[model samples]
Target: MNARAEAFTRCGSAITTNALTKTFHGHTVLQPTHLEIASGEILVLLGPSGCGKTTLLRLIAGLEQPDGPNMIRFDGEDVSALPIEKRNVGMVFQSYALFPNMTVAENVGYGLKVKGIRRKQRESETKRLLALVGLEDYADRRITTVSGGQRQRTALARALAIKPRVLLLDEPLAALDAVLRERLRVEIGLLLREFGITAVYVTHDQAEAMAIGDRIAVMQRGRIEQIGAPKAIYHRPANDFVADFVGTMNRLEGRVSDGILAVDAEHTQARLRVGGGDRSAVVCFRPEVARLTAGPGAIRARVIATTFFGATQRLVAEVAPGRQLQLDLASSLHFAPGQIVAFDADPQAIIEFEKDA
Candidate 1:
């Protein structure tokens, strides 16, 4: 890590929350929740809209006070009752939130300016932060004069200027276009790891959360459903909701008996070695895990459509009366609609859940 990254690591603080609960007009948006973020870790809170991710973030930032008896701590210091201004935390919002009248440097240095720092020291720190975000040359440019990505960089620089103990981001990249979003996702991930600051990021996009977070907390109905690394969350989901939320999961209805899962589909008798005592179950796997094969004992389906991507071809096929399956194949493979094809999933990759799952 570089000098700037080292500086951030020196100031980073571990955060702990105990029985954190939030209520709005008698409706509890966040239940009694306990979370611990290690120093220099980036934890992403991922869920759908109104899932309490933002509420948890606000509670941590002291923007919204939690119910009594709940505690928020920074490096063992209890800050549950501290207001936003006193918490020494940095926040970045979906809206860039830069002052319209301020130039990039002025905006980045606004925190120091508010704290009554000397002009020389504030200018030096502002210059260093601008360099850290690769916006050194844009210091004199007005906020409206820069691109969306540049404006976001300015916001980040401003946040870091205050030497915050923890960083809170609420869909900071949600406003960018797809191309820019993808590009900045990588850049932001590198920046977070380099800075080594404990961060809590809230987002509804699963891909973004997986790409940027060290670990993800999947939330639902104002509670955390699961918390794990990206690979663990995708491959070993704790329940049905998490399995379906993280990615495209293809499911098949079946009955398990004699160490075999027999799928219910016409023209296709699919059976896999799933050891479950005679009971109804659902076998789920990702689209990429299923492949088109000509071997026997594979599930048969009639191709409905094929969409061509640069590296892979995605085929939508009808497996049963109303059931459809999606499979990703090599782009070189050619198949017309209505053509029958047999596909099989890797036995080791299949996940068996209860019928209700």
Candidate 2:
């Protein structure tokens, strides 16, 4: 790594927000959010587009000022009062936002230029950053002439040029195609780790969050529903809302009696650890957990539809009229539609949540 990059790594900054809140037009967009991000760790704020994920990211970047009793701290010092440029934070936007008139190198060196750095120093630093992002030879190329991926790389170079203590990414891959998004996601993860700069990534894509985050914070209504490793968040969600939001889930909603849940009038009852709430409960199981096998506690489901997805088959089965359960099976098995198969899930695979619990 270049000396400029090395300097950013050595800072080893930390970010914390105490009751961070954002409101617009008398409506609270983000509720008070209390979060702590460790030094050099990659924290991803994930949710749908309108769920305040971007608002939270902007608040941290100082792009959106916070509202009362709220604070943003970096390296144990309050930074809420600082302007965006004064925060010394690297931010890569979803829109690459490269100046059309400037060459790749000029855009990369723009931040340094604005800081009044010497011309030779800016040139050397820009070269190092371009090489870092694998765009060294394209330095003189016009921004309009490069591919979307290259333009995104140029945006990264510009952000890093400032030697920011903390890096902020705002849906940086939303513009790329599927292949480029996948490829750059991995590459960005590598670069963040290599540079050892603390990064806060905002995105609604669960796969991206799972792929790049050291720890993920699932945001909803401007509040964090859960925060943990990707696998933990997937396998064990904090609530029904999170389970449904994070991945594909087969939800069976019904009433529970004596720690057992009845899927329907067909008398299929499964062991459930129901606590608190006399109304109804939602039993969630991943499609992959449901097996087409005849055994004790197996419920018969008629396969109504099937779709092939390369390595797996998605089988949609009906437990009752308009009540369906999805099963994920290996591609090796080609079950025909209208076939009745005994569908059962391992006890450990089932997660039950009460409607009012």
Candidate 3:
């Protein structure tokens, strides 16, 4: 297909929810959420267990009902009260959910069969889907005999069988091993792009979310903390929770005063010349922003610990008597565990957030 044709062929439907809220047994499982998932975008809901990421997905899939006021709209029509079967949505579960007695082709063709596609058409579509997932050779293999990756592909093909407008993947990669999960995450992402389906993928794995999502929503305690592109979510988190949860972060709590941020009483500490006023605030800096060098604008620190990765090293240092900070550096630095080092950072790299600011 030509570029435009290929792009046009890969487009799917859009989904949105307004002030979606859910509660269970007097506990709020999903805080009111308003989100717009663009057509053909892969949106990953990421958070720890009990954070309601799955609950939100269930609401969108019409598997869970909204409490009140909240609404789910598909392509501008209200679908909050729609039934699961009538939602035109495909779902892939963590358990693969394939029938043990059915062959791979049978599993892939089951939906088409139920939809009343002719026998010959079902066979042709099954063959095409099997080939699309690179499982054509395993078309007749029983579910029990296929590998986990193959099973995942089978589940995906089966979900795609009915050609639903929206696809919901509920921790689908959780069943695979780490290596296979990584591999399939990429494969599934590619397949979603190829099929042009709008997808809502739920996962707690940060790496998986980063790898597969075009946009990610970081959730906590039934509420979404931030939503943005992967890089924005990682490098420019919305708040302290998002900053600390998405990646390794060092928190310096203090009060911002007179356009400067100070951590402790003795003004001889690493204070940030900020643009905000005096208020209870927290300063955040990623390890990558801290340089292991001695310069005019530097903080003298004592290395407390060092953990080395293949190509990089993470150092935890004491900048003040009781103040600690962390740094990530190249392995070539050759710094010892107990060595005294000077850390420098550009003033602009510092992010200051008032306690209520």
Candidate 2 has a TM-score of 0.92
**TM-score (C-alpha, index-matched) for candidate 1:** 0.96
Task: Please provide, for model 3 over 1-357, each residue's C-alpha lDDT reduced to its tens digit, 9 standing for 90 to 100.
Answer: 334225335446788888889988899999889999988889999999988999999999989899884389988889888899898788999898999999999999999998899999999988988988899999989989999999999999898888787899999999888999888888888887777678999999988899889999999999999999999998888888888778778777776678666666232466555556667777788888887554444455778888898788899887666677888889888877667776665567776665664
lDDT of 2: 0.85
Find the candidate with the highest TM-score and give its number. 1
Q: In candidate 1, what are the lDDT values of residues 1-357, reduced to their tens digit?
A: 877678888788999999889899999999989899999999999999999999999999999989875488899899998999999999898997989999999999999999999999999999999999999999999999999999989998898899999999999999999999999999999998899999999999999999999999999989999999999999988888999999988888878888677787775687655565788888888888887677765788888999998899889888776798889888898999988888888877888776663
lDDT of 3: 0.83
Q: Which is superior by lDDT, 1 or 2?
A: 1
lDDT at position 130, candidate 3: 90
**What's the TM-score of each model vs. the native?**
0.96, 0.92, 0.90
Error of 3 at 38 (Å): 1.4
Between prediction 1 and prediction 2, which has the larger TM-score?
1
* Clashes (candidate 3): 2
- Better structure of 1 and 3 per TM-score: 1
lDDT of 3 at 327: 87
TM-score ranking, high to low:
1, 2, 3
| RMSD of every prediction | 1.4, 2.7, 2.9
